[model samples]
Target: MQHSKLLYEKGILHNKKMLTQSQYSNFKFVARLDQIKTFTAGIKALLFAEHGAFMINEDGFTCTVEQGKCIQASLFMMPACFSEFYVDGVVHFNVNMNVLNECLSIFAGIDCTMKMLYKGPEAPLILVLEPQDECEISTECSIKTTAQEEPMEYSLDDNSSSLNVIFIRGPDLSNIFQEFDKSTEELEITISPRRPHFKIDTLGVMQSESSIEVAKSSDMILMFNCRETTKARYKSSLVRMTQKALSVASKVAIKTDLSGLMEMHFMLQDDSQAEVYIQFFITPLAEMD
Candidate 1:
């Protein structure tokens, strides 16, 4: 929020006498009571104090006239900053020095406490008198910037191709039995990197590795986990389980032909008294010479 227009609307352009002429424009802020604060409504006003950039709440509500670095600001070229009150009204604001002391007390147990501390616990501004020819008004201060830690980001390669992965959480023996017990799913188990190309089920070929946590079932949040020994990274095709009992074991003769093999058998494992879980990838092939 450039300070000029705020002054324009508030009928207070006369306050410009205090700004130190600089290339940077001062901030213009407007706010009203919470109930009356809106896009077009609010007790709007302009303040051109040297101690601009205030913070509000304990990092809750911040105003443009006195907000912090992380406080949301509008795009630089967007004509105005988003720092204005989302709703307007006469919400009271603390003075800069008081805000500093409050911030220090609240952040005492937080990380980066010292980094936020002001030199001698003073606010980042100086209260002073610029010589007025005949009279001196005493309501302004001067401010500057300080170093702080970087904000967080969760950026990933936007260009990476996404694969459709599935998961079977632990051991759903019912799903294991579904193969023979008359349950069916639109299922594509595993594809052969080597041909004859087809999905060959070694279902019920449970290993202790099938247990996993998938935040979303849409197959997007899950990514390739690196294999312990082979170090191969691939997204899980499934993340489900049947039961926790490992004693219940079942071996099934599946009707699918493995690549270059006439037969494929699937072994199912189970927990105490629960259902079973099936697991197997296509039989990896050796490269042709």
Candidate 2:
């Protein structure tokens, strides 16, 4: 069999010390290159904010970025994605997203193998990269860390009225976004149970300003559920951020509560063909008097 693009073998040197005395003990954290790439690609486009929280636990790892506390983007990689995951306590660090993404993708043309480890908060993130060739070259990078910030909480709970929820194909939303007026400051989204189930209205710039609506029975809307009429406006720039995620996602779920808090769930399949979700939360802009 051909060598895998990325390799991660347990007890692979430095991380061996992370193991416990018990034979059943496993490394608290160790992951492959694919997991690293997948998680990073999911949130890279939403890293408008300078800071990102790298959180680790038994469940797996999650990278979260927030924009002025108004928009929150998260990429979650499940425990199964890691080669070995065993965390007795939570580990969190505030790291520069741009720097981290650069380090992860540094090896572009070369078939690089990686080994990742996390000792604790006091220690920096350890990454080892080796080119899969006779070069016998490997590089290790230790990224410094900072205190983690508490993430914003969004309630999509049962109590919160899910005024509107739509499941649409990624390409469909991508196409619609192309027609959005970039010159507009805000974009209006209206969802109702009536004839025009979903609508997008753009203002500013005569030619770019246009209103598009899709009926509940439209093929593009795979699923539609709206209890009552709900209308909300969001910054055109903020809503446009989802364009990247929309391109990779197979299906997209758009949800808005009564408070105008919007949640967009992107369904993505990993290398293993397992389903994973990348969620984005955007708070609607205040109404103009």
Candidate 3:
């Protein structure tokens, strides 16, 4: 009994020592004026899922959300977007995006400045926001973090077929997505270097089948790299998710691998005068028997 009591005391001391050491550890981050807003809007696009995981390193940060294991969305902000960034190594944690977003937006129209801090994996995300205004209000929030789960890795590079490409300006795609037949279960995407470079087919309400085709030489086709025909079908819901990223993107590239995984790369400009990318991946619907 005495030995057991001594062991317990030793464990308590060790924990206290560890806690003290962590308190002195430096993990600090600060974003420039417009970066906070841009980051906020970027992550908001992933609210389709309930939770999000953030991985932070010297390169900056990546926020990811997975849906029903069928789709994965990721937003990356490079180190250039931050005014100051310091971290020992990669830090990974999960959080409720809905709650964290709300907290981040608490201060509005006040020239808000933001800082994030984390001592270690076990610590909560510390946000210090201050608004430079006559009122001079500041807000602090501690968002609890959870263990990071291994994210699904899509082996898009392993596909054997040549890459099929479709380049469309964001505004054009946004307008096209708006016309998508939401009533349809899936959106069929067909691409070839032939006359009709791109084609989208869907069944509208009342079982009406409709298809929109874009000519290869059309002005909307910024770049086309498909030499072989590639036809794949994706869930309308998953395709629609890209609309959020498209809203802020200057342009987007819709590419498909041989295995039929679609990757949407969005080109978003940051206030730091550099471009940032947000990528979304959707698995193609299996062919119906």
Candidate 4:
């Protein structure tokens, strides 16, 4: 597996034109997929926003969406997800998520091969779909693209800051979230090295409070590393944005820094064992007196 890095730097665009003329003769990026369901699943998870930045590199493809400037979600599809993937250097563009989703799902319940092509930053993304069972059926779609915007910076330095990390099975975490009160306005998370190692508290709109505590010895907890007791409050709506990804993930690793930034990595694996990942970064809500 290739190591993937975030290519969100503005300076990287300067290198786009340096590609050889031969590369320009062909599309800057081209990818083929035979398993459309797996690809659509990841895309649907990041559809929280209307438009998103689409990035492709030698490693794979990534789509990122941000909401309220405090919450950001990214979906990564590795090269293994595509039958054929090629990129000159790195390509970044913006596209409408709803349009792309609809195009990909046009032939529902049918096995189809999808081919995607992008000539350059200014060119529209072209998708060609052909039913495998019926050679006569084919569809082509052209979705307009726009310049990429600077990605939001929401990173946590795990080594320098006092951090707490927890690994949990996806289904277990999903079940826990399902129990949260839907009318809650705030979700408070507390982690400690002592008893009731992990806890969640919610304050409803009516000011009613609910709390849940999990023991460190619980079977659902795969690993727990707590440097110190830490507690933070986050917007309930923002935290609930992860439900789609959580429903499909097999495992999840959550990390929180002293600054109250929360990061979660949700891992999804298909029947073929190919892995897809969805990540979320959330900023804590300000406290009141």
lDDT per model vs. reference: 0.24, 0.72, 0.74, 0.82
Q: Candidate 1 vs candidate 4: which has greater lDDT? A: 4
RMSDs, each prediction? 22.4, 4.5, 8.2, 7.7
Number of the candidate with higher lDDT, 2 or 3? 3
Candidate with more favorable, higher TM-score: 1 or 4: 4
Q: Tell me each candidate's TM-score.
A: 0.19, 0.84, 0.85, 0.87
Which pairs clash in model 3? none
lDDT of 4 by residue, 1-289 (tens): 0001111132212233232335435678978787676677778888989998998998889999998678999998888888778888999999999999999888985767787878897888877787778766777778999999968988888695479999989999999999988999999988889977999999999999999898889999989998888889999999999999999888899899668889999998854466678999999987832
Q: Give candidate 2's error at residue 271 in angstroms.
A: 1.2
Cα RMSD, model 2: 4.5
Which parts of model 2 have CA positions greater than 4 angstroms off?
1-28, 33-36, 109-113, 130-137, 205-208
lDDT (10s digit) by residue, model 2, range 1-289:
1111121243334233333346323334555553445555675765677878878886677788888867888877777765555555677888887777677676764556566666566566767766667335666666777889888877575454556788988888889888766797778888889967899888775635678999989888989988888788888888877777787888899998667888998887677564467789999887842
Question: In TM-score terms, which candidate is top?
Answer: 4
Error of 1 at 86 (Å): 14
Model 4, runs deviating above 4 Å: 1-25, 109-111, 131-135
lDDT of 1 by residue, 53-169 (tens): 333222223333312221111101011222222222212222433333333333232222011111211224322221222133222223333432232221223233322222322
- lDDT for model 3 comes to 0.74
